[model samples]
Target chain A: MKKMGKERPGQPGMDRRDFLIRLAKAGATVGVAAGVGYFLHDPFGPRASAEKPPGVLPDFIVPGVGKKIAIATGGGRIKAIDGAIEALGGMGSFIKKGDRVLMKVNCAFASPPSLCATTSPELVAEVTRLCFRAGAASVAVTDNPINDPESCFSLSGIGEAARSSGAELILPRESLFTEFTAPGSSLIRDWPVFTGAFTGVTKLIGICPVKDHHRSGASMAMKNWYGFIGGRRNIFHQNIHTFIKDLALMIKPTLVILDGTFTMVSNGPTGGSLSDLKKTETMIASTDQVAADSAGARLLGKTAKDLPFIMQAERAGVGTADFESLKPYRVSIG
Target chain B: MRRAGVLETCIGVFLLTLLAVIAGGVYWYGANPPKSASGRGPGVSGVPLGVAANLPADLAPFGREETFDPGTLSDKIDGKADLYLSTGFVELTVRRFAKKTDAKSWIELSVYQMRDSAGAFSVYSLQKRKDSKPLNLASSGGGDSAYRTADAIFFAAGPKYFEITSSAPGLMGDMKILAINLVKGQPRSGGLTIESFFPHKFLDRSTISLHMKDVFSMSGLDRVYTAVYTDRGCQVTAFISRRKSPKEAEDIAAAYGKFLLENGGVAAGEMIDAPGAKIYKVFDTYEVVMHRGAFFAGAHEVDKLESAKDVALRVYRKISEVVR
Candidate 1:
């Protein structure tokens, strides 16, 4: 009878205290396990980073660092056109006769050049003239837009200048793209991109307008590479900074021209009101995307301290932020 | 009086013993319930259920350029994928590799139920291969979801996939998920399918394989089961793999064939026997397709094993329709 009581079916023991204690223990265990499990599955974990071969990390870092072209931050005088060409060694350095030169501009935002959110027409025209002067080849300007392609180009000012300067305007599609790999990026492994536009080019120029972004706190040279992405753009917002670095790792641009003629101080990448526009009148150019962006940030009265991404780019050895290291040549552009 | 005290002590001991047994039973039930046959339900939102799940947790929260939109889940394991928002079910999908040192200890798969502030159903957190002993392998490669996210494609909304790679200094494993957009209980485009898809645009010239060739002859599916032969055979010369699930096997083959075709191999033809068997062949020493219910017999070359295993998984991925 005693044994039967011990094995008693429903209420094995009449006391509820022990049941409560076990429940508490189970809850605690599950909670700890949940935390550990969640952390272990983090995307930055070893398994994720292990996917890309070691060759990928330095691959993005090399051109990013080597391409640092510094513009004059002294005297407040801006050299928008000559500064860009000169930093890339006067166009003769890269463009040769019969070489196909492709220039990728950000026409994704439907805004004019004065807003400082779109690539300036003057910047595009100067690059085109430089390419034509350097070679007996074709120079084409185009972009993959998040909005209507033609409208973005025509209204943004890149389309007219590109056509007049003897550069063809191409729309982004599958035909323009090819695949490339990010060697050591935990986020990006290998992906397809605009191949013909990016590959085998004697000279490639990046024209990005400095703007404020809700996500990265700022949009500059590194952020502009998002336009070259072939298939998907929304996923970039998932892990924005790591991917920005990854994209920076892939695009080894010869010149990163910041069109700071009309700086978008606050709301940007698409500023509706003219209130966000400020007359910074100073266009910064550099072979180092990091340096140009850093200089541009300083002009806006914000230092690299506020932007974690700029600091990150600098740490990754993408470019120089120290104004002292760069030889600035101040020239007035009317 | 002493006798009475002993009797009372016995009853108290009996009650404690009974309580322990009941508590243990409850613990066992909570820890190990029969897993659902088809696994947990999909994301209630229109997003793909397993997009992030497709990539290893370490390879997730990847956003291209300046975009780190780690889908709708913002817990950081793979960098900073912290800005996700959704009102439906979300989950993590962890994947385990068969060749890892601690593969057995890791979570083969797990599910977590999520709810929004309204206490409504939100995300189904699925974690695959969640636990494993620390590996001693050197660094090898990373996953695609992070890079894709970094590049700004919402891969978490694309397809359910995973990969295990071992490179020079390290070995790696990952799970990737395709985002799901639920439409009246159906899935959006780009989700996984259970049927073999046409590799090339033309279906008539596709390769096929079989086991127990005579069995297909008896079953009258021979017209459907095509056969081919190559130089290598078994585990040494050919490809052999054991998958954890039918879905996994199918996914591997599809992805492998895609890789091969993309890399420059042509689908010359296919061979078959019983669904799964002991013997297998390598058509080009670079590729092999195993039918359902097959075990590889020998070891294969190191260079070709990866590709061959991938093709085998692809075959398994699309093995749902064996209609007579």
Candidate 2:
């Protein structure tokens, strides 16, 4: 063990908090190395490609892959989840062991599996299990439920699913929020947020249900981050598109998973009527929140142009809108 | 008889033409009243006197009286004491300017020392009350000076008791008279005798503002003092209390600067040129202020805690003088 006073090469006056963050990152890096599947590399720079063919690229630009999404389905079940995952390499491709993994699942409504108001419990569980298997040291599954958390989690089956999948459920409460200063932001400067276990964590994954929203037209990946903010949620509703865009800039999630298996056609992030459900038989996964939401919007037969938040998120560089670069991999499941 | 017949004929001829034109003019006037008449008042045609004669003489003070008797007033009348709901999420209280029929004498300003359950009297309302109607003047535009009510009371003895009241709604329980004075003469009418004094010089390190704490959220300085300054004389004289340690007082002095710089009270560059002075520490303090200069050879330690306190007071007085 290194002495506490022995500072890292570049650190100056590193306090206990900084030391802990670095220690966690180091532990995660070592654990990922031991897992020996895919490797974690800094995403801020151009990544060196693995010894794989062009057809089975280890990585694709996050924004490019999000625009058009595809979930493999065959014989009424998922046949190639691992194949789709392998296409972009493996879990090790993005995350490392000991990384604080925060999964944002859709628990917006108190409806059963068939209602489509929330992401299907099966999809959420699969994502949770995959993240744990990927060497995530700590997995925290959370969502800001519009309905009561207990009812929403139970009826949507997310609570049980997250538990069984080895993910801790983080209920949205004021106690979980912490103050963050966003410099240069006009509407919000110092605001309170739940701070998706991501700040010091190695990776952040957005697991959101594709649904229609009253204010911004669509509640997709970018809008999902709004749940993390507390104190003044109503202020965001005043100008939702700008708020969503600003939130996307703030969140900067590592990956986006659009649970399009059952898309809410209307009256959501909380839907009630039976006619509001639409079965897309698809799951959109990408690194770009904008592109993932754009594809999710398209699943509902709505264009990115129709969803103002998506356009704003895209304009803010949260994702891309151009369908050509989306690079969708439509796989068949069993 | 011939002259009377001619006069009758002229009157009849004039009446016939005038009647035809008068009817049209009256119709036009009915449709549009002249704009000048509309501009004279609120044009509502009713005195908005608000709640009339319902409030107890003690709580509402309907007529001019030496003292208010709370027992006679209504217990919980709606909108008591003529507090008008104002725009911008605020309400304004009514203090009928103590109508002194005599021109020479002004009403005495009275600072009500509201007594809490403990019986200690303070000028401000420390707690939130639901519906108690005490003799409190409500106000809006949430600024409170440290001794503004005190000063208002100080100058009230002369003649014009600026019918002062708390800036909050509802009653303030039982209140006793703390201090009384008239502000000599109306400062507006060549009467500028009323002055604030602070014995210390360092107290002027920060800008002083007279405002309420809860309303402004502890953002502004609520310090008050008075002193006359000459063009060539030192303006930085300050005072402090004897109780606190010199080091502690110095830290307190630095706190004023910290607050000013950190909380947008004053620009960092602006503090360099502000002047300083030394004086005896007591109830109030004074300081000399310079908008663009240095002071006290870079804020050193003075002799005693009292001296330090005096400096703090002086700083406050200097700031108050500059602000005033």
Candidate 3:
């Protein structure tokens, strides 16, 4: 209301001194903000947890006779799995009396069991029966499948096998996942692991199929542990070999079963047609996941060298790449 | 009274802008709350995926009809997601259907929608099953690239590739019905492609592969179609790629030869049938590479050099016929 740059009596219009004070206050506010921002800014977004948790998954390796391996040929899953286990000193050697066992099966897809996209229900049912036969107190069938856990479990025929075999079906829920980070590991950074399934569980067994993986070249025993991983896990496929090696380190399974009754020779991990399958007619079981996958590679018409994960896992000392060195007991089941 | 200084005025303006931004943030946060990442699981819709798929009569939906986007494609198909993503993958919808007559017998139908029909065919032909019988697709009104397996049918129509797989051996009829319905509904498409340039005689159509990038680990080789041939008990694979200019095609051809050499392939000699053709023996297999006009063509991974040269000559002749 006053003329420009003119002062009014008792109005106390903005003076140079007041302007300087206001400027100082404003400058101080911005400076403090900039200082705070400069001090707290994380240029590299979020990183792997400050400290790696000590022993994420329990080392379920049995005291002695842990690295045993067995290969069975020419049979259905029921006979093949049983023969392979028998050659590994039977379920008693791993699942003891009063032990609570967890079977991590590859029920990643909602496809039918016959498709070989998931573990065969016959194999799971037989394994559950053998676990009970070995005097296990409780056995849980669990997998954080890529699809809806319930749908994957139900459509893959694993749910009925679990329920019918008196095994608890542990479906992965939000509450079940625990953020995990492995020491000296990459790609598995503060990732959600289905840790709840391991609660009160003693022995762990991974049952997987021998199939071609478009990214990793093969989905074998070591790849089965992927089901234990949760939360936007597709990102791990970017570095699948290292991720599989990390999985090998994360889950030191008491045993791993490689189902190759019918091997997915091509278009795998999720082969959509029957022609993608070939009758390899073999099954492998081992305490050494690397060795199991090495033996299982033949089913995919490849060798350990063909799949980089096998070599990675071997280099990580998860198991021996020369599966034959284990002197795998060869069994035949009709 | 004093006029506002330039430094204070600029600071005042910035402060006002910051205040406005804060207000906008408050409004935005009030309107849209943070979502919980933990709650995200499987289905893309509010309802379960099993009931979301559209199906025809005589076949009932078996389970959720799941879908995966470019970001989530790896969730559905695992490692195979890269194959589709590299070839312009858009969306992948997977649904299973059971024969109403026999509930236990079911087939999984996965339809991968690509950016274009070429991308679709690239995926379809790339993963074409070995030893499969190429379907005339007579059941699907013809013109569709399809094949039949013991328990399934795979086809590419327009910008979508369809894979109908069944565990039951006798569900081929059910799969065919599904394929026909899907093919008819897909967008209009161009028939064949550069793939038609390959000699059909003795060529295994089902074994034809279309690699979008880094064919045989050669970065310069892209959008290549390789078809296998079985002649006189000898199995050979032939490759073809079309470029915009003849110079580009020739460069790519020579580059592939260089790539082979860098990867332990030795230059053996040249083929008399095709001028400027380079031959290489890699490990136990033979490779022949050449270009004609804007077409980059070759024969690959032949056990015998005789078969490799013969197939390369045939491919060169075929390209010449098409280029002119």
Candidate 4:
């Protein structure tokens, strides 16, 4: 066996023992300096108390492939939903046989559907029926509302529609959320996420209504995922554009459906008066959430470039802001 | 010699271990950032902490008060004031009073303390609409304006903006009473003196406004006071911004001019008489911007270039005199 500090012959340097001594002395001096420097200037000390941990991506996500968006206009909610989804291929294209489907619907407020603040019950019911007809084993409807969950679901008429359509209305309970970490995100780290609806669910669908948001410019399909967040998530609004883009990165849904039957022109996300709403009678279905929101913006007389979130999401490689380039299928349902 | 060698080796190992410990500490801190305390707290900027005590108790109402720092303001307004966070928002206090008889019969009072009066006015003006009914309140002046809806009253005074909302009918009287009390609690200060610099001739009093954040959708311009005027069958708007320094004012004026040129406006050959003022014609309307001392003023949407320059120069002269 060779000695511990034995040097090989023909090597042009000090003996192994001498080299080891010098290296140890140099390392010791550097390490002591580094330790003192760390004490003097702790670069990674506690951050601002208001700063939140990064948001977490969903554990199970359905990848989007060859995504297409379809816009159906000139019809009631049910007809528009049908025409839009059919144009995107069909219900069978998203929901497969024996799949457990989870529908994330926007029930942000307890207001009735006529106020256009929440998703229309007729549209939710029709989509539930379509999923079941496509051979989905179970369809669960869920939302973490801004108002009281039970009242929001019940008064919004979404509860009755889900029950009558043979779907389970999953109300978010305190125990249902789990702390999740979204790695490599400046915002939304170690946040509470509603995990109850994801149990045994193989497919995910997002249903949202287009409306003018006082902060985010507009709330569309991408904003629909805000329902999955729990706790004091409103703090995310401090950087509304980044939060929206982070949401797009967090959830990868099978399909995104934008309900524009009655677009809220102003004072929205929670419109109180009927005068704030306009009957656009439109629906957009797409596999790409960013693309769906880009098209939905047009219904509110805004372009993709007008919203910071849409541009940010596009730049983040989530989807394209040039939604027109996708050559969406346009239909008129009478 | 052998003992010294062993001592050096041990010291090196000890230092290396200490460095590792420090590195681990940093990583742990980065991984787990501190979180704000989750509950109601005292008011910011030495504002009264007990908001409920200041309110009338005989209203037969139950009250709750919450104070929010700039980072957590979204919690107070449910994200409604997210846009204002960029404008130097400091803190906010929200007091909610609800009658026991009906949950819908409630009053929500919010007091926002910004970095300065300019920031407060910016948030106030952003929320104001042209259709709202103007209210004559004791605190209305110096970049302060009050407007009311059937159930809501919004006003700004000094470094604070107030919002009083009620779901109950016929609460305007109560709102006014609350406003007077709120003004009493605030520090007395002069109104936005910039309003006095505008020429009263051809000025429309009702149209006078101070845009806190941006003017006409153009960014980098804050604390801009604007008023409309009727001149020879044409309507024109004159705006002025009092910046911290002349250089800063000049930069903003230049930025506004560049914005106009980028947005389909053409630079005109005839310049305004004021030092550093440029004229532009955009969409059949003339626009002019100028800077004097710490004051930046401009006129936009006039029918003719000469008329726009005339308004711009007059406002610029007035601001220069005030600065002098």
Candidate 5:
């Protein structure tokens, strides 16, 4: 009757003596774990710089140049990019002889080229050609696309652009990603970055279409740096404005080309249809990412005030949101 | 007992546990099985996403159907996944179909299964293109409505929100037919729609939308339904949100007023007709906030004071009718 009133042990291994033995086994496991931890701890040996929080990014900014922005309005992609770059002291000014350039393009989707969700293929090809012509040693095209790397590259015509131009297409893989955390960053702590593509990279150039983002107000220059992130990066979109601010701090590119040839004004970031695009017919090139996005916002019928990331980036001292403050050169194309 | 016997017993117990786990798993999965993105599932009383993914026979399947749970929803949709996740996301099933006649022609079908009818509609209305033409899907087949752009058809029926984006624009007819066929497969239910609460008088039905969270930059002020109206030469936005209690509604209304005040809004005194209603002049625009029973109502960012008051009064009376 006493046994019936009490809850019995479910198994023979859970008897009183067996329970004590299990407890002892758990204690031993803890002891072993502590011992291993103690053994691995190298107190007073190489503690200063070893296993540092950062695998630091190379300084890709074009130093010794004052902040500049150039806007080319109403022209073909080639003419606009050419005119904008010419205004900003030309491609040769940034990409020097023997300089290795990394082209960070937004191949975020594997959609049709007409959709303009990804960076234009012609833009990538043209940029690569210009970098090589500027006496660059090697110019590699890379992006950690949201879709399958091969498909995003192939269907977006970026793969063909890179292949035909002889620019190394560094497709993101698990092996290529390195965990990165920026100093004083809130969002991108211990985050995997496509760092392998940055190997021996001297100058970095950002090339992406200005599109209406459903989460962030606009996907422009700073948002393009989101491509460098890996390992389920979509989580960052929760604090999207902060994430874009972090991206601004992460990459300091030489030239950011905001392709507004046909801005995805609505249903964006992943615009499925041709109607989503509007022929804003403008190209913004800048040494400052904040200024580029600020100008790009106009194409989307938005000001810097509409996108919180613009002010956040400005507050972070990444760049100034006031494109006018930079004394921007505005040119009209035929 | 010999050491080898104890080892054998532990191994036997471990194997038994493993077998039991495997058996339990098999039974559970058999009952709630892994379904293809195109396959239909049973609906739950609460937010059942009876996903009914389909395509017309004219188009062939381009690739294998893909599915994503809440955790990996961002993988497929990227940053936009945040909006759905923050709302009431469940599962997403994606399948691409190519035109039989032309290999280059393709359409990507993204079917989002939200928590309920409200969640689905919130997503659909939130992402509705400015130039979308309304489609009568409920009359044609199932409940609720649909809209189509040049190259896409976005519609919410029951708990399922459908987005079909094609390669080219002007594929509306084909996509509409595809949407109709897809809608026919799902069970019809009048999902939780809060937009009807907004008075039809001077209300733009096309602009009627439900914002799930962070409406007007207020953190806790959520599940807000807002619509624009062309009243008195000004496009005034009328907002409404249903709270759990009358007190909660009052508190949010006050907080919204306070939020505006903190951000450079000036008190413009109370309205003449409505008691417990306040108005504010913010940056030359008029803003009004009020609450009645379990509903918080307001008008925001209106150019004209009369327009703002008119929309607010209408919304207030509309809620008063319901809660009273």
Candidate 6:
């Protein structure tokens, strides 16, 4: 909880000379307070820049966790999702009765699903349906899009899919964000987080498509957390790897779904040409984000060492980079 | 009487000051009018409102045109904003026309005005691919470099980059006619004449490309022109770039040499016949790089060292002739 700024007192019918004097006095007071606050909270000061908010813990860890990852292949997106979730011991293993599940989907671009820049709406609908069938109280689909929020959601067809599957669509608004601090980050100190959507959410799931990123090399489950951050986040591109590692440590997701049904091979993050896409027809469900991203990197013809964030996250003790050692359950469906 | 005189003088001064302020306001308004309020016509700076009139009337199309400056171009082509921004985009005019005969048959024409010819060439060159078919039109540079897809045609003339995409197939002819008209409507600002340095004897017109930045995955190597040539079942890629100075050109050529050596390329020593030219064997092909004056030229992916030397010397001689 943060205090609001003090409102300026109205000075009706005041003379111009008197008003100027009052404004000068107020300005001096604000300048002194700001200087003192800066010394106390400056990112470059002796004090630690990142601080975790109260009452928030890593919610991604499931009790009695078993297999680390599941890889499903040779099916459409919906089938692949179902098979992957089933291999991980079904949706019931994660979502219990009356649990509010938040599905953070990759709707970064307003591109149609055929472009393979966003998660498939059909997969979102199926996941929502499965969550409800598993006795979840409610399911919500949300993302802070790179393009216009409403247009990205609508064009990607995720909005309609969530509605038909009885899930609410949450779009980020300016007023809905709250300032958040990461516990141990070099870049992200105090930043805006869409806290309104996370209210009362018991379990969190990330559904993102594997695609080439112009800056980060590849975008997967770990990179999907970028949508949860607000403000002029584009500046983070200067230090993309560090920001991504910080993001991995910020949120603990119950499960992550990596959509590889159609992976964008080149000019990605926002692919404009259909030629840039390659059909891998695969999906992965995992409890370890670093392991999931490592698998996604391999799909892009890269190793975990190739992407700095993967290794960085691994060293940060967020998850494991040795995805093969996790012994991911592999299945093929017609 | 003295007090009355002072009052009159004050009133006169106030009236004069008011008059000056009004005159200044009028001048400022004229000089800084909004883009929409500017006169609409056709040219390098004209914002044509009736864009459909510029098209062939037989197409029977309804047109909607919008103009954007650097601040607002992202609202239109959000996905490709980075590409346009990198090219020094100044203004963009987009016209969407749908055929009245069949609404499904439509075309969109986008004209991007860049800062200069280099900027226009950058935007045009980045989109060029090896498979794009040549489109012959009567624009600047003869429009011979224009490439067409099944539904889109892209070309650049002067500091203007043009893209005309149609919804229906087999609109290549119509797109060409439209491009010619667009070129005819605007004043000629000149084309990238440096492209002519490549020899015409063995040049593959379809394979000619300009890379604004990062040629051969090497960053900071900007404004590079490349073309492919085939002779006796051997293919060669010729590249040329103009740098700020002779020293810069030499440094870039040396950097490329080092990059090749670090990436599995073996040094094959200098070409004795051509002074200042180095040869290397890289990935089953003979590579040669040379610097002449402010221009650095190279030939790569040739089957034989002699063929590589032949193309490299030719480009080297051409750059010397053009630059000198």
Q: TM-score, each model?
A: 0.42, 0.40, 0.86, 0.66, 0.81, 0.73
Off by over 4 Å in 5: A1-50, A61-66, A96-99, A135-137, A181-190, A214-216, A238-246, A302-320, B1-54, B192-195, B243-267, B292-294, B316-324
- Candidate 3 lDDT over B135-233, as tens digits, reads 766455543688887777888888888788885778777676666666654665673577678898889777777788888987756888888898677
Report clashes for each candidate as comma-separated counts: 140, 78, 3, 9, 1, 1
lDDT of 5 at A252: 83
Per-residue lDDT tens digits for candidate 3, residues A1-334, read 4333876685457666776777898899999989987997778764446565644678788998758888899877788888889988888988889999999999888777777989988888899999999999999998887566777788789999999999999998879887788766877777778888999999998887889888888998888888888877887888889999988988888888888999998888888666778888899898888888898888777899998998988888888999889898999876
Instruction: Looking at model 5, give its docking quality level.
Output: acceptable
Q: Tell me how each candidate scores on DockQ against the true complex.
A: 0.01, 0.01, 0.50, 0.21, 0.34, 0.11
**How many backbone overlaps does candidate 5 show?**
1
Model 2 residue runs over 4 Å out of place are A1-83, B1-324
Model 6, B82-143: lDDT tens per residue? 67776679988765565656754666677888887777777776666444567766533344
Query: Top DockQ: which candidate number?
Result: 3
TM-score of 5: 0.81
B1-324 per-residue lDDT for model 4 (tens digits): 134467779997999899799999987986765333123443352224345455555344333345677655544344465656766788876655655556545566778887877667666665564456777676532324677766677877788888776645755676776676676645543546777888887887657666766567886566778888777767778988788899998888888888999999998855536767888888899888888888888897788766677777778778877777
Rank ordering of all candidates by lDDT, starting from the highest: 5, 3, 6, 4, 1, 2
How much of the real interface does each model capture, measured as fnat?
0.00, 0.00, 0.82, 0.13, 0.52, 0.00
Give the clash count for model 1.
Answer: 140
> Chain A TM-scores, one per candidate?
0.73, 0.73, 0.88, 0.82, 0.86, 0.84
Better of 2 and 6 by lDDT: 6
Candidate 1 lDDT by residue in tens digits, A1-334? 1232353464455345555666787899899978976875656522223344443211212232344454533232225566645655666666668867777777765444545567877778877887789873888787776444664687567899898888888776667765455655665544555665654455666787777665676778877877776544556676787777777766777667777666766534554334456667676766777777777786566877677667777778666667447765454544
Give the per-residue lDDT digits (tens) of candidate 6, residues A1-334.
Answer: 1222443465334555555776897899899978976875645633222464532434656779854899999888888899999999999999999999999998876555666778888989999999999999999999987335875797678999999999999998978777777678766666777878888888999998999886788989999998888765666776889899999998899999999988877756765445556789889999999999999888898999999999999999999999999999997989
Worst 10 residues of 5 chain A by lDDT: A1-10
lDDT of each: 0.48, 0.46, 0.82, 0.75, 0.82, 0.77
The residue pairs found clashing in candidate 5 are B47-B115
Alpha carbon lDDT of residue B124, candidate 6?
A: 72
- Candidate 3 stretches with Cα past 4 Å from truth are A1-41, A46-49, B1-55, B62-64, B99-103, B138-143, B167-170
